[model samples]
Target chain A: MPEPVLELDRLVVRYGSFTALHGLSARFAGGALGLLGPNGAGKSSLLRCILGLVRPAAGTVRVAGRDARRARSEVRRRIGYMPERDSFVPGMSGVRALAHLAEVCGFRPDDAMLRAHDVLHFVGLGEERYREVAGYSVGMRQRWKLAAALVHDPDILFLDEPTNGLDPRGRARMLTVIDRVRREHGLHLILASHLLPDVERLCDEVWVLDRGRLKMADSLERLTAAARGAKRVRTRPEAAAALAAAARAAGLVVADGAAEAELVLTRPEAEVAPAEVFALAASCGAPVLGVRPAARSLEDAFLEALEGD
Target chain B: MAFRATEYERFTGRRARRPVWWPVCTATLRRGWSSRWVRLLSFGALAVAFGFTALFYFAYQVMPNWPTLLRVLGEDEGMASGFPVQFYAGLLHVFVYPILLPLSLLFGHDLVARDLTSNALETYFSRPVSPAAYVLGRTLAYTGFLLLTTLGPMLWIWAFDAATGPQGRFGEIAFVPLALIQGLVPVALVLALFIQAVSSVTRSGVWTNLAVIVLFFFGFVAGQILYEESDRPEVVSVPAASGGRNEAEPAAAAATTPAQAPVPAEETADNGPEPTVPADAPPRIRPDRLPLALLVGAALALVGGDPTPLLLAAPTLLFSGDRQDGRPPAAASAAVGRRGPPAGAGRSADRRPAPASPEERIVVHHDPRLLAVSITEVIRGWCLGCLDRSYPEEVRRAQAGRRHRFRATEPRQVPVDLARNVLLGLGGLSLLLLFARLRRQGTVG
Candidate 1:
């Protein structure tokens, strides 16, 4: 098997006596892994540790099977990072900063410059080569920063709130750019965001962390199923009781709401699809209603996991 | 394969290309210079030049004749004042040029340290540039800015003298560069070194610049005390008189033996001498003292170069006409054949090589032990211990010139002198701690 792109074992980070990361342990396979957390939940800190910016006080962090804290330069060379901050080398045109950053990443100056130009063009910044970064718009700056991170064509791209502080259109553009980088390049992406919708849209797997501890790390499909709520169906009055009785007979948690008919599927996604309930309802001679799929979102799961319900 | 190749060809043809780093280096340099502190420092340097020019002009007015002006400058009137043209031409060469007050203590404070306090250091360092390159490149830019601010007024004074004044000659201008080398450069160097050192050791520019202000001020205060002590060791028991004191009693003045004996001449009992002359020049010997003061002026201009403690220590170093006190400003580099009692003594033995060797230019102040500790700190900072196999023993040896000498002299007895050293240690330690903390949390990765 190919090695995990990122591995963390009991990692901890502290400031003075206060801890930012409390024994957080996680290992991620090579794919788009969404690190979902609320603010101050250590998601950004985790990405920094992987980037080798923050050294773990305890345990180990290995990026692409090499110790990240130890072989930081090597690890840095292999990864791209888009920080959430608006920090940029001001007074520089977009192309210059990217080129220099690439050079620092071990590319020869000439090749690095060429690669920087290519990436800036790729990110739609071809014309602003000499324009200083200080004047870039919020969206333009985000794109420029993206160009810098991608200039080296890194294998694993760690994005910290890349959509943050962007206008809706800007956010959409950023998402498209990030989605392309992940899809077209087959890059391993570790995206940290408080927005569950973004994770749902882009991530194959999700790792939810709360208060510096890993709440859950699994495929989005698994997490949603684990936290699945009662499956609701809309129907006329007569069939509600029959459908409720049959759902109970099938050992599903039955809830007959005043406004709708519902069946709570206790089994996870693998056991059954919500469509199966229609067949059960039909066979039991219950009047038919429109059947619907299960609804158990990452948001629900995140809250459930954190609240311990 | 043919169709795929055709598509690849088309893709390559479509790509738009341009020069890179247009944004990076330019942006980096701009943010690096767009600092308020830099602007403030530059203004301060200008203000200082103006202040000095005003003071000197007033002094020149009161002592219209060369004889009287010489006395105001504190010299023996009977001694050769180099030339009347030479004496007035090279006012900056004397210890009281007024340039040192700003460039050394004010403008030089912000060079490297400003980046750290403004939080621009981490932003710039994150790019692929090495620390050494960053320092050199940035230092060059800052020094250029400093030179312009400082030398601008001196040029004006030169131009004014050339157009209208009695000592107006082309040769008079040679004194400008000389004064720059002697009276200005050492102080500039001192300012730059301390600024950089403080910046290197502190993560914040405010603290680093503040550290410099405190260090330079204390150095000034300490130099005053040292000057007093060196001149009249007997004065140690005697309390210093208030109001003012004689220039001859200054430590820098004490270091030089009487040249041609004290030349006797009448005090300038005329036209209420230069208004800006120190309140206590006795009005008479101010003219006589001028030539004596002017005597070492040329020698001073010839010798003083870099004031970085190590640079000043080399053989046959330049001398500073240091008015404030402390070591004489000269080419008195302390290549002291590995002697003691000379940290900033900056004195060196006379040793010239037949030919330049690999280490010829390198002054190796050998300390394997200090280097060992610094190297270990670097290794640990990089987490190199994880890979036990390392470079060979000989290759691991550090360059000899960059070791620390922790042994400081009379720091306890001389609290002010010890203050800077103690602060340097503290600044270094704090940076280490911050770096370590940043390492663990991964912000610096």
Candidate 2:
């Protein structure tokens, strides 16, 4: 019902003869949308186009219902960007760098300073805010960049590899903060990353890209749904063999593992039901703990999408 | 205390719409001042200012007793009375060369280069700041710093001079501050933008500083070389001979009828009688031939035909001189006066028949090479030497009878005008080029 936060119509970008993005036409709804792509797959280029940092060779980039090329300043005002690189004003303290960026984003000096302090605290750098950015560790630098990006309170936060180069704990902290920003602050988020699990955990929708082309754009729920060929079953260890036999006798393919059994449901999922499985389990005199749709992981879905392209 | 309460709160407070450049300008100024070297240099500038103020105070205290003081110091009376304009000129020279130039170069070397190397330009331009605003902010930062060192001290010295100097002369020198602003502002702006433009292209601060230094000092060195070579004896010999011949025709005719001329005894006593030339000898050249040739060459150079002198003395050309006294150094005055007939030419006509006229009394054999050497010496003295040393011995000879009015013609004024035009043109062109380069690089927003 609401306009998409970012819309690209047949966008094409090139540097000399090497095209970074080719005819990337997509509409990202106003929610968490993960931009999944391998390195050099035009993920950064696409984000740059959406932010109006790079001009599209062909087609249009509309951000918040305005032409990004024509209304660049207005568009940028509505969006916050955390670049993948270590970009910060050198020799400046964390608070000063954030405040400077906030001021450039159209805030008064005092307001910017207050907001910088607030954001630095929010990003878990409250104590280190006074230290120069040069002295900050890699994780702290990432947090500092996030604080600067969020200091302006933009409508859409464009984070390019927000968790890149972070240790496991630091990555978890960053992910948690980003998730909170999206859920609590209620701002549209475009997360660009190569890590599939991070995307699957945080984003509702996923747009997989490969070789400058969009492989698939759909909700994570729909993308990783049951592959329409198998059902996984959980039952007593002694009952797993009997359950597989019953499943086979019921005209479904079955494979038994050590703890559970998987049924290759020859019949469509529309026709198969939990009641049928329960009736079969009773006849076989086996206890059935649970039966659910077996779906591919996000990594599988992403690799499959790229494979199809 | 803890900022926990405000953490993760959206900054919904009303945002203020300030000029985009103000934050950047303030930040740059703060960063620059935070550096220890900048603080030290600023203190040095202040010390120089106070030192000058004290010097002026002491000079004024001894003004009434200048004759006795001059005797005690074994200095000429001219040095005491000629304090206002020349003194300010020396002060300006010291400020620009040693203090302001180095400080500006140091401040500007990293201004843009750091942004580029650290990729902060993306952060800056990704926001509401435009390229023009970025440039304006950075340029203003350097300009502000340079002004603190330059205009601040200059005004301090001017205040001391106005208070200690004669009241009647105050009106004349009152505009020195204005001249300084007009003169130094462009110098500062040009240096700032020029350095910024260079920084935009390179990522190393050392390289940027090197480039700026090379540009400023190399231009000065090259200009000095060109000026020396162009004003050399070989280049002026033929011109001086022709100039001498043109003057000799009228001078020889006056010398022939000595009975009709009844030269005054006082005039003859003051300047020994001019030597008579044999009718078979070549035309005699006046001792002032070399200075005349230099004056002519400098005038022709100003008309856009020749740029040797203009290029060499660019800084001197752009200088507005001490506006308070209205009398720039004599060398500058003479350089500017080149377009008109030579100074004291009219007086030469009236005294020509006297045979011992101060102008004709110093005649020597008209050798083209020798005349060229004379012209070369005068130009070298005026162009490369200090103001006191710039006056040619020929001009000194003519001033022997009227030492009270001696003013060495300053050739720097010619280059000053030329330098202004050249710098303005270069600044405009460099700005355009910088804009285009930034656009092409597409590294901003």
Candidate 3:
């Protein structure tokens, strides 16, 4: 019911003869939305368009209901952007750079400095905040960029490849910071990344894009739930046949198994409760060990969406 | 002791609205001022200022009792008295041209280039700052440095002059500060915007600096060439009745005549006198075919009466040669004495008149087309000359002396004109606009 943080209406973007985005229209609600796309899938281009760095060839882009073209400065003031690339002044110290950017964003010098320090600490770069950005390691630079983005404390954060170019541990740390920003600060996040697990871990909704077109846009729960057509039930080999028969009689499609059996439910887990499964098992006189949804991972879903187009 | 928790705190304090360009301007200034080369250049500028100040102070103190100082030094009294303005203008020319212009390259070379190369424009443009603000901030930063080098020393000298000079001279030199600002600010602003514009086109600081240096040197060299070519003389033989020259004499006699001829190139190989153009030699441009309008325009502009021709010749106008004192170069004067029949010497034989005294037999040669060009040059020289208010009168007297010999001397008062100031100011503004447009296009980023 809250206004969408970002809305694009029939937005078309072209670079020379190559069209990067073709009539792309979508509304990103105020929450963590994953902008999932492969390389060259117009993800970065869309983000740039939202930030007003690249003008749309057709249609309109609005941030918080303000036209980005007409009220660019006002729109930018309420949004924080961490570009996918390394985008810091090379020779400047992280804190100084953040403070300077904050000042440019319309903060007083003292307030900018104080906010820079606070954000640096918040992003877990408190000790290394004084070091020159050029000398920072990849992980450190990522954290520093996050700090800079948060320094102004905008309404929404546009993070492009937030976990890009990081080791496993570094990636985990970055994701944790992103998650914290969403949960603790309660700021809307539009995270553009190719790593589906990263998106699934932090995002409430996912927007899958491929070849400059939106293939799917839905909540993570609904997307994964729809992909999951069946649930695998583990039971004693002797009771498997009886369970299968019982599941079939209950309007559930059951698959034959050598050692176990699979149950294709008539409805989603959200629609049908787990109590029904246990009751069916008791009626069939079968001992149930465990039951799990047999659905494709988010990565599989993303790839399937791309291939579907 | 009670256990305390450490965590990130949100800054909820009162936020004030700061100027969008403040951060960019301050950061650029801090970086430029902290550069070792910039610091060294600043010291050098201050050193030059101190040297001038010391000279002025010493002259002020000693000129009252030293009655023979002007005579012995062979310097004019006006120059001795009006040294502050002269020194200020001279220092400005030196600083703005040779020093500050190149130093601006160093100061602004990386301003926009670094942002583009490092992808920092994404971060900057994503903020609330607009492209115009970015350009304004960079220009201001470079202009601040330029002012420090060019105007900063002028102010120092003015203050020192007022404080240390004799009582009455301070009021006489009061206009020095205004003149310095008028002459130097436009040049500084132009250089700053020009360099920033260059910086915005490339991602390499070295390349930007090189481009700026090349542009400056090219403009200067091209201006000098055009000015010299515009001043080339036109030779016209005066009638024997007017200047008393023999018509029967061979035209080559003008070059061979011992007393009137120039010192031969071989004789003047060392430190004798500069070799003169032979009087009989054809003029660089034929007088009959001269572009009269261009010549007249150049002359009027030079005299500050009309600026149209000077505007047309703007490339060469600013580099007009230095002001000439009354004393003519020995070679020019020597060349003046050699005279023969005019161009088409054979046709004038029948119209020859009887010869007169040697001094009266002088030939007159002037470039009618170059009159404006020469006047503009002379005016520029006089405007920059150290003779104060008497400079124009001195130039007039020199023109009168030349006119007595039937040589062309169009005496005209040449003040610095408003047209020139407007042209230069427009040049700076155009560059600023260009830089802003480039910024809006996101060229540098």
Candidate 4:
């Protein structure tokens, strides 16, 4: 019953003639929220509108119960944004640049400097804090950006493609740092990423967008839990329709699986046994090629959201 | 203590309501002052100030005893007695032209452009600072340095002049500081905004510096060309009056034109009298040319406060060859002493003047000084000359209102002072709008 961290009211964003967000309306309660979409899906545009960078063509965006447009500075003060691109003040040491940004965000000078050092330490840039941010390598710059975002200690954090372009070790390090920040600090998060596993590991809620439309918004728990008691059935491409019909006729909830010629069958009240799935396919004049349990995963939910009407 | 990369720690300290632009201004100052070129130039500016003060002191002390030495140094007879108005004018020229100009170039090239090149504007706007505040902070940083270099030393010299002069000299020259401020502040503010605007366009420090250098070089080159061309005699055709047949009518029509091209005095002396067109003679076809020299001179005048450039620009505007008919006259040297029967000139010849009408005559009068002096210089010089001529008596008058003197006689120098003021005002406004646009596009796009 606390105000949702973000409330978007039929938000419409356009760049010249092209619409980026088509009347998006949603409310995100405070928690780790994952925004999942492919390229040009308006994920970054939505972040920009929330950050007060892009003015909406129509409708309103509210952050923490304040109008994002009217109260932009106040709203921005409570939110830290890690942009998708490599951004930093040139000619400044990493620590000094972070401190300058913190000061810009209204932090006391001494406290800003101390917080800058501490955040750098937290993000594993403590050793390179004295080096110019312009000289930082790809992974180091990513860590430095994360450090900058955290230096202000805002209430909500917006991370745009945080793990982008990172090697395996670097990606793991970034995720670990983000996870620690979210879990230990109890900060609210609105993380926009294309990597679903990264979301699954950190976020409890998800919003899926495709081509400027919000396809689904729900708790990650329920999205994945809906796949429980389901079996993934793979058969010949020609037998897909017959197997799906058979499973539906058996009073099971059936949907398309993530791969070709596959059907996922679930019963809301009970478990869907693989042997039962095979029997249903066999009786319906469909070949029972393979049967396996459909484990809970965000990828299935995400792809389903994209695939759904 | 051993270093450890650990969990994130929240900042628990209190926040302050410091002006958001403070950090930006300070950062700009710090970065610019940290540059080796800027520091070295700053010292050079200081050294120039000291050297000028010493020169003025020595001139006042030694020049009085040796008029011959004063004459050798090109010191007019009046300057040998006391620090004249030229003292302040000379001070402004030395301070702005040599010391502050390059210093500003070195210090200000990267102020805004570096942020753009580094893609830091988004990070800046992502904070609480507005575009206006960002621009203001940058301008303030550059303006502060210029004022420090310009007004700071000028005032020191003025005080030195007041202290070292003969008794009661302070009362005579009390208006010098006011004049310095009136002249210097706008130059500083305009330059600060101008460089930043240039930076926004070029988006690189080195390129913006190059652009500034090119613009100045063009101004210098254009000023020289205008000066040479304006030094020549020009031929122009006067249009006959609409209904009048008297001599005054044509003269009145000619007076309406912005400037009258002067013929060489020798040519006029040899022509015996102003030549009249016979009614039977055919008129020549010619058209009026736009005043290119005046415009170029006015534009170049906006760059400096020394007034010498303005003086140089004025003659070009007034006397540049604007041939109304026939092929462009050969250079100034070739056109002299050629007095032939008048050819049909100007489209106005179609409305043929009656044989008895004096308007049919082509009158040419020449003043040797037109090529050497601009109308603005004439007016400004007249004001300054009046002050210099009346120096012993008009000190009280000068003290009462020397600042308003140029503005009061604005009708005389309209083409010069007005154009300079309008260009400066428009230039400042355009720079402001450019900064806003840069911020708006930078943030979202």
- Which candidate leads the pack in lDDT? 4
Per-model DockQ = 0.12, 0.39, 0.31, 0.62
CAPRI band of model 2? Answer: acceptable
Tens digit per residue, CA lDDT, model 4, A42-64: 99999988988888999999999
Q: Best TM-score goes to which candidate? A: 4
Q: Give per-model TM-scores.
A: 0.55, 0.70, 0.69, 0.76
| Winning candidate number (DockQ) | 4
- The chain B TM-scores of all candidates, as shown, are 0.39, 0.60, 0.56, 0.60
Q: Say which prediction, candidate 2 or candidate 3, comes out ahead on TM-score.
A: 2
- Let me know the TM-score candidate 1 reaches against the reference structure: 0.55
Candidate 4 colliding pairs, count:
8
Give the fraction of reference interface contacts each candidate recovers. Answer: 0.15, 0.67, 0.63, 0.71
Candidate 2: tens digits of C-alpha lDDT, residues B151-215:
79889888876777655446535656766676677767877776777776665788988876776
Candidate numbers, best DockQ first, in rank order? 4, 2, 3, 1
Report the candidate with higher DockQ, 1 versus 3.
Answer: 3
lDDT score for residue A101 of model 3: 88
Q: Please report, in order, the local distance difference test score of every candidate based on alpha carbons.
A: 0.49, 0.64, 0.63, 0.67
lDDT of 4 by residue, B224-307 (tens): 344333322233323332221222111111122212112123322233554432222222211111134433543554444233
